[model samples]
Target: MNLDDDPPPTDAAAALRLIEDQQSATARRLNPDARLLYWPWGVAWLVGFGLFFLRFTPGERALVDLPNWLPLTVLFVLLAVAGAIQAVASKRAYGQVSGDSARRGRWYGYAWALGSVGVYAGLGRISEHLPHDLAALLWSATAVGFTGALEMAGGAIWLDRDLFRLGVWISVINLIGAIAGPGWHALVVAVAGGGGILVVGALARRRQRQRQQP
Candidate 1:
């Protein structure tokens, strides 16, 4: 229980191992699991937008008989849940780590908050002027586009290839869906955008496990 009572590392190898152990602990504390960062959004997109596709298929008649407000409600609820999860994960990972990285993270978080407000403000005004289907497409495209842009920015900040690639993929699908129009957009994003993120999250977790192994 006394600091002076314990023996130190007996050899160079022991000392190196001690250092490695400390570095690993610090890394873990500094980097939250990628699954936590990604999977929540993946599920949100997958289920939320999947429902959107069913409910708002391009034709006036919906493929599935869902309440008019159900898809939007579910999507917003899931997005809020994802945001909460990411916020908690970020706080736990970076709460103690200070420096430029912490500053950048805080700024990035601010960007997300402010960018969302701006997007909603602009969309709210313009969406009212558009037809229902076009309005829906505009909302989905812009939301996805905003997310992809932020993902790319985060990747650039962290120098994370996986994150950047995921962002690129999201952005591409968003564009394609926008071009394709409403029903198809939701289907594409729900399948490709959401599914791709899930795959990336799984791969990231696998890499983390491999790195942690002896």
Candidate 2:
């Protein structure tokens, strides 16, 4: 019996074992730290946006009526923190993955950063012709919706199904918000955009934990 010349395993048990091994290898190649960072960042964005939207609603006047700069300040602070976490996670992922994957992730980050700046600038330029409130609503929806598109692109690049699904869900939510118009923009953004991010984050966390388990 020559082992080198033997046919590959084709029985049900053998096939199952092979599949499991492949999955294990894929899991091992993924960045655990990156997976862990996602849900918390999502939660932070949810809280930040929730507070920002409070100003327009009657129920949370305390949050809404604070100095105009306060909410913006808090939101930016949270974003900075999230950025730091992402940087750390990226470093950890870089250590584990190939150079090409790390470089891809870096370029993806750059694209998002540039895209955000472009969205803001473009919105500001065109806002002059529209009513103030309508312009603001359009700005918010477009900016946030662009983020979703980037997520979808990243998911496709990485072959991450969950992230891809999250991107689609986010785009749908933003579309609904747009259709709802300026009157419901704040509420839609808070409930749909923020909440969608939170849900996606939680799903990512759960999937990561399951993959880590024996």
Candidate 3:
């Protein structure tokens, strides 16, 4: 019989092997190292925003009197550094992999970028009519919500439970902050947004190290 006309394999041994192969492939595609690549980015965000909030605290007056542009500049610099770290880490982790998982990761980055623009623009427009403190609080809360949504979407797309849990934590924290009102806005962002990112980053690093152990 011609090779093209051969029947599908029906042997029990062959079926078992096929199943094992599929499972192996799936495991490889969801490489755990890929998740670890976000650790640095998370840490950077935590540190950057944590410092930003310190200025507002009574005892921490270092950045309080600095030109507003200085904080913005520092934030941009930190973001650039974090982006570089992520790029390098991702290349090391997923450079050899090609297929749906890789494609999804690339698209997820795009989604986050687009979502950030939308959040900034929307918040800016809405802040116009609100009082200064209220506007600031709303902006912070909405930004947190946007970040949570991105993390949740990314986790679902990549099949990462850790990221999904982090997303939920962020959303819940933001909601609580919102309910507490503008008075505690800065504290909420510092504790919830910065602290949450730090915790997640540390957890990711720990998991990565554990997986690498012999």
Candidate 4:
């Protein structure tokens, strides 16, 4: 309507708009809370798998290679998978400092432990009736060695302090199981491995809640 009218805004107005744009971008960028979206879902699936195997019907049991041992097999698989997911999620957890070595700190290291269960089941079938001590020794040695490799590699990869500690712990567990046999190995993992994870998880949760509050 008027060539004489000043073009939409002055240089000062344009500069002000540019500053606001930059601020808006920074505010909207990804933040740690973004993780909350997927975390619950992952946890739900993790628990669901646990309950599923626990409640396996006889019919379902017949399907697996080791149907009678379905509960144990399923349990280990679930544990290993959870470990893998943790590893992956930890890596995906961006814009935050990572405390673990890349793959070593993850539950996938648990995949080896799970596979060892499969080995136990296979061994059970081969013998008319395999002894528990023998099976436990086999599983323990394999689990510890595999877990150690994972931890060692992870320690090397991320130079994680925890990985080295974890490897030491796993190796000790393995050694004890091999030396003492099954009965004691079960006690060690149940009391030490499982219990330790629970304590760690609880502490981490408490810390996380505290951070979110402020």
lDDT on C-alpha atoms for all candidate structures: 0.90, 0.72, 0.69, 0.50
Please list the residue runs of candidate 3 whose C-alpha ends up more than 4 Å from where it truly belongs after superposition: 1-39, 57-66
Each model's TM-score, in the order given?
A: 0.92, 0.75, 0.69, 0.46
What C-alpha lDDT does candidate 1 achieve relative to the native structure? 0.90
Sort by lDDT, best first: what order? 1, 2, 3, 4
User: Which runs of model 1 end up more than 4 angstroms from their true locations?
Assistant: 1-6
Worst 10 residues of 2 by lDDT: 55-64
Q: Give candidate 1's error at residue 79 in angstroms.
A: 0.6
Put down candidate 4 lDDT per residue, 63-140, tens digits, no spaces.
224344554565566655665665555445533544443344345446556766786677567544556445544654
Q: Give the top-scoring candidate (TM-score).
A: 1
lDDT (Cα, tens digit) per residue for candidate 1, span 151-203: 89988998988889899999999999888887899999999999999999998
Cα displacement (Å) at residue 146, model 3: 0.9
lDDT of 3 at 170: 82
Instruction: Name the candidate, 2 or 4, with the larger TM-score value.
Output: 2
- Residue by residue across 4-58, what tens digits does model 2's lDDT show? 9777677889988888887876665566544455755565557666666675443
Q: Which ten residues in a row have the lowest lDDT in candidate 1?
A: 205-214
- The C-alpha RMSD in Å for every predicted model, in order, reads 2.6, 5.3, 6.3, 10.7
Q: What tens-digit string does per-residue lDDT give for candidate 3 at 13-126?
A: 897887777776655544545444555555555655555555444342544565645543665687788777777766765788899878988899888889889889988888
* Residue pairs with clashing backbones, model 3: none
